[model samples]
Structure formats: structure tokens, C-alpha cells
Target chain A: DTAVSQTPKYLVTQMGNDKSIKCEQNLGHDTMYWYKQDSKKFLKIMFSYNNKELIINETVPNRFSPKSPDKAHLNLHINSLELGDSAVYFCASSLKTDTQYFGPGTRLTVL
Target chain B: AQSVTQPDIHITVSEGASLELRCNYSYGATPYLFWYVQSPGQGLQLLLKYFSGDTLVQGIKGFEAEFKRSQSSFNLRKPSVHWSDAAEYFCAVVMTTDSWGKLQFGAGTQVVVTP
Candidate 1:
């Protein structure tokens, strides 16, 4: 069984289009997180949710939003995506503040 | 501001040769350090971590790291290299705040292995 999984491994959309990436974890972890890896391969934390409660919100733009309906799922929705929003987004889950298990990652490209 | 730094952008080595990947961290508080490896088209896997106790930490695949508090460095080293070990190595530090699983990763270092 996959510990963490993300949908739409590859995403290609036009600029200004709205899209959402879904993430789920089966590791029974209470904390889930979202990270964005840019073209330079610098993986930075975007947001984190503990037990479906927002905890960490980085200096990301307002167009990016994270939704967690439950502890097992954390989704990222981007409104009015721009060309600069192209990057690889990875989802991860962990047992509190510990070593995290990461998903395969979702590659998004805005043209 | 907590951050992780991997100075080596790329490193190549021959099979059976020794390998060392440098990792430096800057954190105000006691830092939880980690080393992760990512194969092509795969998710990141934890190789090892340094929370406390001994400075030298052993990880899977014959990998080990030594955390030097004086230098603020956690460097990953292996006695020998294998072709399968060619991957991107990331150095990360866990945040001390209430937020969970927020890892500040360095710009990864790409390793290539030759026969």
C-alpha cells in the first residue's frame, strides 16, 4: 500500500486557469504538508496542517490555497495560475514533528 | 530563520569509490537534521536523521552522517559507492515550531556514478 499519494502526476494548463491537486495519506499520520520545488530544485514548505488545523503558512501568494477536509487529505488549489507557477508540488505526512513520508509529486506547468 | 545549505550542486564518483556529500544548517534552536535521497521519478526517502544523542548517526544502505555542533554541519558519507546510488541528495532541517512536517530542504546535490 502506498503511504502517500497525489493525483495528476503531470499537469499542463493555460495561464489564468484554476486547478487543484489532491493528496492523500494512509500512514495514519496527524500532520500533512505541502511543498513546492522550483526549477532550481529548492524544496520549500508551502503549508502544513495538523489534524486538519492550519499551522504553517509560508510566504506564498494569496492565489494559492490549501484545503484539508480531514486529517487524511490535503488539497492545494491555485486560482488564476500564472506562468511562474510552474513547479513540482509534493505532499507529505508525518506523525507530528518527525520524519515525513513524501508522495511522488505533482508537476504543474502553466503556459 | 532556519535554513539548510548544500554547496555541492553536482558530484560524480566511480563505483567502489568513497562518497561524501556536504550539508550545512543554520538554525537558532536545537535542530533536527535529516538526509534524504530521491531517485529519478520517485519520492524522497529518508536516509538518516540527527535528533540527539551520539553525533554519528547510521542510516540505511550503508550511509552514515556525523553532526558537528561546532560547525553546524551534518555531512553524509559512505565507504563505497554503487551505481544504483546515483540520485539527488537533499539536506533538510525540521522546524521547531508547532507546525508539523515542515522541512526546509537545501538545493539538492545531484550525484552521478560511473562504472
Candidate 2:
């Protein structure tokens, strides 16, 4: 069984469109995170949620928002997607103290 | 601010040869260090992590990392690398600050193992 899973492995959208990526973890972890990997392969933390509560919010634009319905699910929604948003988005989960487990990642292409 | 630095952007090694990837970090206090590997079109996988206790930490896929406080370094090493090991490796550090498990990652290093 996959510990972490993401829906729509690949997403292609036009500029100014709205899109959402869903992530689920079966490891029963309490903390979930969203990370963006740029074209240069630099990974940066975008947001983090613990027990359905938003805990960390980086300097991301207001267009991007993350929602956690429960401890097992965290979804990312992008509004008016721009060309710069073209990159791979990764979903990960971890317990209060341990290494994070990652999903298969969703490659987002904004044209 | 905690930061990770991977000086070598790319490294090539022959199959069955020993391999080493250097990672350096800058932080005010002892930080939690980690090494992760990412295959093409895949999410990053945790290789090893150093929290406390023994500096040497062993991980899956025959990978291991050593944490040196004086040098502020956490270097990953493998006795013999297989061709399948060719991938992009990332070094990361987590600060003790109560920011809800924030991790600072390095630029990453691409490893190419040839037969």
C-alpha cells in the first residue's frame, strides 16, 4: 500500500485558470506539508498542517492556498495560475518526530 | 537562519565504486540533518536523518550519513554504488524552532553512475 498518494500525477492548465491538487496519507501521520520544486530542482516548503490546523505558511503568494480537511488529507488550490507556477508539487507527511514520507508528486504545467 | 549547502552540483562514479556526497550546513545550534534522494519524475525519498545520539546514521538502500558538529557537515557515503543509484540527491536541515517541522533544503547534487 502506498503511504502517501497524490491525485492527477500530471496537470496541464492555462494561465489564469484555477486548479487543485489532492493528497492523502495512510500512515496516520499528524503533520502534512506541501513543497514546490522549481525548474532548477530547488525544493521549498510552501505550507504545513498539523491535525487539520495550518501551522506554517511561507512567503507564498495569496493565490496559492492549502486546506486540510483532516489529519490524513491536505489539498492545494492555485488561483489564476501563472507561468511561473509550472513546477512539480510534492506532498509529504510525518509524525510529530520522524522523517517525512513523500508522495509520487504532481507535475504542474501552466501555459 | 538555517541553510544547507551542497557544493558539488554533479558527480559521476563508476559502477561498484565508492561514492560520497558532501553537505554543509550553517545554524546557530545543533540542527536536525537529513539526506534525500529523488529519481526522475518521482518525489523525494528520505535516505537518512540525524537527530541526536550517534552521529553516524544508517538508512535504507545502503545509504549512510555522518553528522559532524565541529564541521557543521552531514556527508553521505556508500561503499559501492550501483547504476540504479544514479539520481538527484538533496541535503536538508530542520531547525529546532517551533515552526511546525520546517525543513531547509540545499540546491541538490545529481549523481550519475556509469557501467
Candidate 3:
């Protein structure tokens, strides 16, 4: 039983294409987060949701949207994906003031 | 305005040698520190964390970190480096003022272990 899991481990699409990544956590946490790791392996927070309520929204492009259907799931959708959007996206979940658990990343490649 | 710094971009060490990765944070209040490791093409895994109580904290995989409030540093140390220990290490801090616990991560340091 994985604590956190993501779908579509690898994604390859041309520029202007739209894509989505799904994440779910079995840990029953109230807070979830999305992070982007660029080619240089520098990770930055993108969005955070607590109990399906949006919390932290970093200075990310508007094309990237995070939707939380429930406390256990958080999905990211990229509209008109660009070359710069090609990177590894990670989903993490945690209790308030607790250590976060990350899921397997989804690597997006923009051709 | 808060930031985490990992001074070394890359480090090379021989197997069985000791390893130390330095981390420093810039925040006014008492900080919550963490160390995470990411293997090639893998997600990050928590190595250790320093919240309170003890200045020295032990973590999984035979790793330990010492937090020095005066220096604003929480450096990770491993007594013996193994080949599997070669990975990118990141230093992060949770802002005390933030209730959601948003983490500020460093640029990460790549460790190369030689046999």
C-alpha cells in the first residue's frame, strides 16, 4: 500500500497540448501540495490545498490548475502546455505541522 | 523573504567515507528544518527533521542532523557513505508563521560516490 501514488509516470506531448496528472493519498491527510522540479532539479511549490480548500498558490503560470475532489485526491491540469512546463511534478500530503509524504513523480516532456 | 541554502552544488566521496552536507536557513523565528533525498528519477524521501526538543536528531538510513540555532544551521551527517547513498540532497524549512507549513527548499546537492 503506497502512502501516495500518481498516474502516468511519463508523459510526452507536443507544445500547445493539454495534459493532466492525478494524485491520491491513503494517509488520510487534510493538506496536500503540488511541487515542480525543473531540469536543474530545483523544486518549487506550485499549489497547496487543505481539506479541498486552496491555500498556497505560488507564482505559477495560470495554465496550471489544481483541483481537489476530496481531501485524499489532488489533480493537476495544464492547459496549452509549453516547453517550459516540461518537468517532474510531485504530489505530497501531510497532516498539519507534520512531515509530508511524496508520491512517485510524473515527468512531462514537451516536444 | 525566507530561504534555504545548500552551499555545495555537488560533492564526491569514496565509499565507506564519512559525508557531511551543510544547510543554513534565513528566518527570524525558530525554524523547522528537514532534509530530503531524491534518487535518480525518483521522488524525494525524508532523511531527517529537526522540530524541537533535541538539537541532534536521528533519521532513517543511518543519518543524523544537528541543529544549531545560533548559526541557523542544520547540517546532515552520515558516518559511512554507501554507493546507494549517492543522490541529490535537499535542505528545507517550514516557516513558523505559516499555518499550512509551506516548505522552502534549497537548490539541492548531488552526491557522487566512488567505489
Candidate 1's C-alpha runs over 4 A off are: B97-101
How much of the true contact map at the interface does candidate 3 reproduce, as a fraction? 0.81
- List native contact recovery per candidate, as a fraction of 1: 0.92, 0.73, 0.81
Per-residue lDDT of model 1, residues B2-112, tens digit only? 678899999999999999999998888768889999998788999999889999999999999999989999999999999999999999988665446578889999999
Against the true structure, whose lDDT is highest? 3
Instruction: Please tell me what DockQ candidate 1 reaches.
Output: 0.77
Kindly report which residue stretches of model 2 are placed more than 4 angstroms away from their true locations once superposed: none
Clashing pairs in 3: none
lDDT of 1 by residue, A35-69 (tens): 99888888988999999999999999999999999
Give interface RMSD, per candidate.
Answer: 1.4, 1.4, 0.7
lDDT string for model 3 (A1-111, tens) is 999999989999999999999999999899999999999999998999999999999999899999999999999999998999989999999997689889989999999
Superposed by TM-score, candidate 3 places the C-alpha of residue B73 at a distance from the truth, in angstroms, of: 0.4
